[model samples]
Target: MEERKQLKKTLKPHWVWAIAFGSAVGWGAFVLPGDWMAAAGPLGVILGFSIGALLMIVIAVSYGQLIQKLPVSGGEFAYAYFGFGRYHASFCGWFLTLGYMCIVALNASALALLIKFVLPGVAMQGLMYNIAGWDVYGGEVLVACIALITFAYLNIRGTSISGFMQFIFCLTLIAGLSLLVIAMILHPSSSFSNVQPLFNPEIGAVSAVIAIIAISPWAYVGFDNIPQAAEEFNFSPKKAFKLIVIALLCAAATYSLTIIATAVAMPWQSLIAQETVWGTGLVVENAYGTIGVILLSISLAMGIFTGLNGFYVATSRLLFAMGRAEILPRVFAKLHPKYETPFVGIIFTCLITLSAPFFGRQALLWVVDMSAIGVTIAYFYCCAVAYRLFSWTSTADTDVIVSPAKKAMTLLGLISSTGFFLLLVVPGSPGFLGTPSWIALFIWIAIGFVFFMMKRKDFARIPKEKLDYNIFGKTLESESISSNTTKKEA
Candidate 1:
């Protein structure tokens, strides 16, 4: 059989960066922190944002180093394969893909929620009618399902088109955020007092720090997304790293300002009592009236759509990478003959995402929190790999340099991410209440290990030397020899 043609490496640097930003910005800015704040209080939100952003930078930088060293489509899986082994890599890839799918579903559900704000009367009336004995939210679920299907179809139609759509959505989101900033600045109630220090001396600084780190996990949620685009990035790890940083900065600024604006415009007591996810929208409405609410709802909906599309892209690529390594069914590796996209995997992901809305909003949040746990586990592993690559290795590879600053950052990041994961697993915490996220991860990894042993012979065919680093720097002769040997042996 003829070898399958590789995907076209056509995404520009800007789009690559936008994907990372879009993935991080989604419903997270509007929804996630409020939930955390409600649970912990304003003190928690303040501490969480500060510490979370700091920890996120460490993980992003480590990933930057890892992607520079090994720019492959597998993200955490690719790093684990080289640093640990095929089995470990497969486990990371599978979990990461699963997490992305959950994010996609979460985004879809958020979009549905936003729709109610935009058309409350219609939504409420639909709920009263109780089509199929459900409610308007059920109708919203149907709408979100349709939206996911439409995007999946669009993605299969072509990568360039999908990328362009994502670009437009991202630009619209940024423009909407800019408008929000202007509105908040012009609001009669706006003041710097909204940004008061969250932790007082009486709060016990050390305990406050721990609480902040625990809450901040929401802010660092999307950093793993960059590595998933390795193939589309032409293997340029440095460029990818810059994109991740830029995205994180944009997200942090938006989050900090949003929190401050909300606190300033609305009383802390009222904000804390908000049980609805639409609290952000309510704040915008109060600040600027109907137009402000419309803009906020539209921006949030766009953010969710763009985020879902980005996650679809990343998750499909991750599955494709696993399939290429024979850890998953070969069908997942198949590219559309004309579009050169992973059509099957994308379709499957959309189906899963569409089905997820039935779980209700809180249940959906629990799923996302669980997925976040998986991502944190992946980040911890990536930090370890970064430390190993930088400290223990003597190779002349620029990507592996162990700068004292980077080392310190990586160590801190490792500690923060690991501790955050433990916090998530605590009873009464988001990940602990419903399904134990850690337990789910363990079961998922075990399944991957079983599959790895079943296909150990196929994995052995690809030599350790060839798989050690990304396909970027090797000489032409070395590439040819490895390619020929693998083909002949297979």
Candidate 2:
């Protein structure tokens, strides 16, 4: 069973870096810069993201340690199991599932939005219905479905193919974005003077920056993805930390540059304040005409493509991990006989993502808001696990000698992860969920509970040693937890 569950080891170091960087710099950077600027202004976005990246680097230290120890497909899911046994693993797995799937779905829906912005009236051919004050269109849904299917196939074909494509996409995306920033610099009308105000007036500078800081888990969610594919790395797993940090820095710079590029194209305040769906697109269109939009299109397409490709990989591996543990249906654990990819898991994710476009563009925000909560929950689990592993005082199995500095980083990771969680759930908080988002979040939690209950009996029957083999490929009796309780979950 363990052998059957193993995935191919074809992912190169550069390919791994591309997965993290490419996934982190997704549709959100291009499409939501104006919204971010409206919420926190240009300087706030820059400072907020830079600081957020630093915090994520702290978290990445925990991930690096855990990945070096476990080096599995489940990433945080396996880490949670190693630290606190099965129940906490379930909690981490279920929530991270939400984070990964929602991002995948969001990117697919974003593809439709990209089409709507680029081609305009073309996707409006068949008006399906009105959803969240946004019109649902059949043409848009079809386009999103096709894109989803194409990415799903690319993944199912083999990681060698998909991983190679991700590298190419990352290169093109960086080059295209570099061109956008350069064009903004040379444009006659573009000026740093436009970014005069650095804060949202209503919220104040401190509050606005804090708000952006709170969403760090969501913004830098994909860097954690390095661990998700760590098991597939063709290079040393020890290099995972450096790759994650490198990706976080690059992603932060990309986000800041994109926002600054938009602001410098015209007046920052006026561009963001305008009632336009695609404010950055409008800025480029007005300033540089079709040439600008065409340039923007390359970046946008690569962003969306990389997002779809990357998240699909993360979500599938997670489901595959959970399925192998029998927390989910065993079918999810199945792999393609030929490609050795997680085809069942891939197909399952694709099927779920297919419904996203039908909900219309506005619905994507609700999912995005809700996913922050999920990823933040997973972040807390990962950091907490790392803290225990490092701070374990028992001399038994003291082979893992962690430095004081590394231990301090894990503590900071815990604090920052907790802060991220509080921001999302706290009422009137900057990252608090709206009514629609709360509703979606609750429905997902309820479904997870239902699945847990239904599988409770079957899971209880599995022996702990067998469960360990299914998940980590061996019994982890040495991977002891430092917690007070020794409760085990099936």
Candidate 3:
């Protein structure tokens, strides 16, 4: 009870939106646009993202309903726990946890590469070795390690400080993108016709859109992070729902404009042919020279930081939830006496992130694809759980009411998420994830299976009375009473 009182609710409504939006945008905005444009062409990429946004909207509705209804820290895990059962909940939470860690690793590699890009020979001076064809450097690895530690420390200190940093980084990214778009519009050399090839011959129009859709989940994965921090929100649960929707919409717009600006500045064919994947930087350099590179690089830092920091917060909370439930080791549930943060989880996550920089960027890209698969599966499961809850709760009085329209939306989310997952693994689909991605997915699943066997007894029988009832992580008397009622009903 004393420990529950230590977890404070300090995140404001706006901060919730900022963190979600910022996390969703991430380093993908700057790096992946070139590939997205190449795969789907400018028009096709835009159309695909629009379609993707609609699909996400459906999923967001389900998440909104669940978050408001549960108002718990473990977002997806909590939904699965209440709707399905402990065993299913652990599976859902474990997969999402793996997905979040993959993303954190992805961001770490991206950060190291970005440092090498901006700093040049400074980090690249000593070629430590080679991994998967990319040259590894001790200095670059050091930079990434330092960054990982910094983010972990920030989160360990407290959520309030971390949330504030997220807001600032998000604003900086928005400002940087705004400046670039304005500059592109004003450039005398720029042309709207540069986006001419709406679909490329190599991937075709349908395939292009499908490819974008295949990766869309990762590009917009941050909205789900909102629910992980639900216990920290200061406003009503309904506001948290609205903020998620708003954040995704904003992310969709930001991505479209960023792609358009890049496309208008440089032809898609030219970008595809570039030897380096730093297409966004090259486009900015083409339009505004060194000044543009510097601006975009700064924006890139903000984008990368948002994903790194937001996911750091998210993955730790996830570990905390699982640990508290005795699904994972209880060490993950340990909180700092002074900060009341998940210090053990944070450190464990940081140690995992330490591996990504060594494997280099290409390896992390495959890891991101694998992460997308896991996230898609988790989304599919959550949609199933959400739909079930909608049916079961009709007669129950709950804080979050699911209307007929919301119910329909949840069904739509289930269909779309299922379809998206199929597109990833289906044999003949245009967006069939490649061999490496599948291999990675299988390996992750195997590891999870091993862990599950070790905890089989706990999974077979969960102690509902022993479960933490302070959904908001607060020790209010009313919350304890409500929790008891909930456990009794269960």
Top model by lDDT, which number? 2
User: Could you tell me the TM-score of candidate 2?
Assistant: 0.97
Give per-residue CA lDDT, model 2, range 156-248, as digits (tens). 999988889999999999999999999987899999888878788889898889889988888888987888887798888999999898899
Q: Estimate each model's TM-score.
A: 0.84, 0.97, 0.92
Cα lDDT over the full model 2: 0.86
Please give the ranking of all candidate structures by TM-score, highest first, separated by commas.
2, 3, 1
Error of 2 at 285 (Å): 0.7
Error of 2 at 441 (Å): 1.3
Query: Cα miss at 468, model 2 (Å)?
Result: 1.0
Error of 3 at 238 (Å): 0.8
Give every collision pair in model 2. none
How does each model score on lDDT? Answer: 0.69, 0.86, 0.80
Q: Whose TM-score is greatest here? A: 2
